[model samples]
Target: MEFYKLKANPKRLFLLDGSGALVSAFFLGLVLPSFGPLCGMPKNVLYLLSVIACIFALYSFACYFFLRRNRKPFLRGIALANLSYCFLTIALLCRYSQSLTIFGWTYFGLELFIIGILIRFELKYASVR
Candidate 1:
């Protein structure tokens, strides 16, 4: 087993992450309600999570602006914000497990996985190297 360090161009990382977050925000908020219950989340919870995704997407874009400015401190703040959001998401999912249907759980599990990956990249690249 080996621990490989995450490596990438910081600016590119922000751009790609920003794109992904925006896409997720779109699907989570706009597409889900079209076929209610398919998402396995209660209507209210679904809307709430969708709004959160939108906010996350906005923050991701903010990260891009920070990267554009070459401001290390703001980039660090974005990374920390991402970390905090992911943790909060996981906690919310766990606490609301009872509200989640099978599909809901699966969807959120995948969300956590992707967030975990992105957060790793952010934390790694944001650190002194």
Candidate 2:
């Protein structure tokens, strides 16, 4: 649970999060544009979502490199940022869905699970001193 241990083993969590972020970004950036049209969201809203996704992707990439450096602040920042995104995603899903589909529920569950794991990892590995 030492900082060094967390720093050393951070790859698993980092890759998990970074990959998720990248995938989310890609969906929002590329796939969502088409999906949005089908989903009935306006072009303006779709563009806004795409912009947001691009920003999230950039942030995720930054966190990936920062975590690679093993800097405590960057680790903390990444956790916070991802947590925020998870919450926002959940809220969006709930707001948008008329009735939750299996896919929606599964995605929400996975996001929450990952957030919980990241929280535990952060606490366990955070510098005590």
Candidate 3:
């Protein structure tokens, strides 16, 4: 009449993903706007977009890290949120053609790489149950 429980170690992969998301958000929110004019972008628009990006980034990171230690539902919710932000960022960058600057391109590439790795990690461990 007793129930058993299962637990898993904290995976560093998620941490990496969280870090990447933070960096990306910082780049898009703070770094990008600060240099948007130099990059030949409209400062007002870019800065506004950067603000939005930052908000999304912070949300993603919080969701993941906050729940990663104890709640599976929260962890999954945050992971999905992070993934959504990743996709949205990519789409926004492509739509606006703002990925031309060296810094912009590099940040985008790093985010994509992190996202890919996160996905692979999830798939690899999908059968853990």
Candidate 4:
């Protein structure tokens, strides 16, 4: 884990997280809705997820710009938020498993995997001095 680089400049983490969250919001809120039938996830649920992503993005961006120090709490906050999102997604997946298409499963699975990786980095760096 190249936490040394992150420790040197934790601001970069906020940027990366914010950017990823924006992408998630865009896809979930705008792009995915058009493919609802193929994805087999409701539009409302996707929009809700997108809204959450937007909130995450806002928090990350705010931290990046405004936080001069004491970032551990914010980092943990995002990590926890990401964990909560993963759990919510898992629950949704289970609830909609019967209706969710292969594409939906694949998409959500990839999202979970990616976020899980990010969460690991966030948590690890948050623990460092």
Candidate 5:
């Protein structure tokens, strides 16, 4: 689909974002610590980020439900938030470049890619185009 013309149904977009956040929260918060050291990342930092992800997930769910009436801003907010996070993660990855394993880098790349896609979708379709 052409990005300029692409528009996602608000409900579906919200569902997708909320679901992704929740899943990431679970994996990062609950499952990642055990493998952190093996992956060369600090367990404490991983743990902290995981908890932050969980908080984000909870807020996403709230936004999904509460922002239905005021959707354009909501969508914009989600996109901007994701964009900021994507950039932040990239910075963090760079800072810890020497510590991350191949798996860690690959995962970071994928995370950035997915979030970028979401930002694009939201920016393209969230407005009255």
Candidate 6:
């Protein structure tokens, strides 16, 4: 779907954000932690990231379901949260660069790229009248 069309119905952004956060939570909380040796991120750190993702998911989903109007602030809120997540991921990546394997680098790089796109969409749509 062309995201530019989302200006007409911005609530869909919440669904997209919530779904992405849910996936991030699952991977960070479960899948990646189990493969800690390969990913090279500490399990506790992975779990911490997962918990943050879960919170983001809840906020997005809540806004998607309950907020009937005035969603701009909420959309921006999630966009900011996602941006923060990217920063945290970058910090973790730098801190763990020595231990992080190719897979870890690739995973986080892809995740940041994807979330960056989502943040752009969210911010763009939120700015629309």
Off by over 4 Å in 3: 1-8, 11-17, 37-70, 122-127
lDDT of 6 by residue, 1-129 (tens): 477667777899999999999999999999998876999989999999999999999999999999999999999999999999999999999998999999999999999999999999999888887
Candidates ranked by lDDT, best first? 6, 4, 5, 1, 2, 3
Ranking by TM-score: 6, 4, 5, 1, 2, 3
For model 6, the superposed segments whose C-alpha errors exceed 4 Å read: none
Q: Stretches of candidate 4 above 4 Å error?
A: none
Each model's C-alpha lDDT? 0.67, 0.58, 0.54, 0.92, 0.71, 0.93
Model 6 pairs whose backbones collide: none
Most lDDT-accurate candidate = 6
Please, what are the lDDT tens digits per residue for candidate 5 over residues 11-50? 5677677777777667666676777655556777667667
| Candidate 4, 1-129: lDDT as tens digits | 376787789888898889999999998999989876889999999999999999999999999999998999999999999999999999999998998999998989999998998899999989886
TM-score of each: 0.76, 0.59, 0.57, 0.95, 0.84, 0.97
Considering only N, C-alpha and C atoms within 3 Å, which residue pairs clash in candidate 5? none
How does candidate 2 score on lDDT? 0.58
Model number with the top TM-score: 6
- For model 3, the local distance difference test gives 0.54
Greater-lDDT candidate between 1 and 4: 4
- Report model 3's TM-score to 2 decimal places: 0.57
How far residue 40's Cα lies from its native spot in candidate 2, in Å, is 8.9
Instruction: Give RMSD to native, each candidate.
Output: 3.6, 4.6, 7.0, 1.2, 2.6, 0.8
lDDT of 3 by residue, 1-129 (tens): 001111244344445455665665566566777776444334554555556546645654565466544444444555566566567657766765743666556656776676666654544443345
| C-alpha-based local distance difference test score of model 1 | 0.67
lDDT agreement of model 6 with the native: 0.93
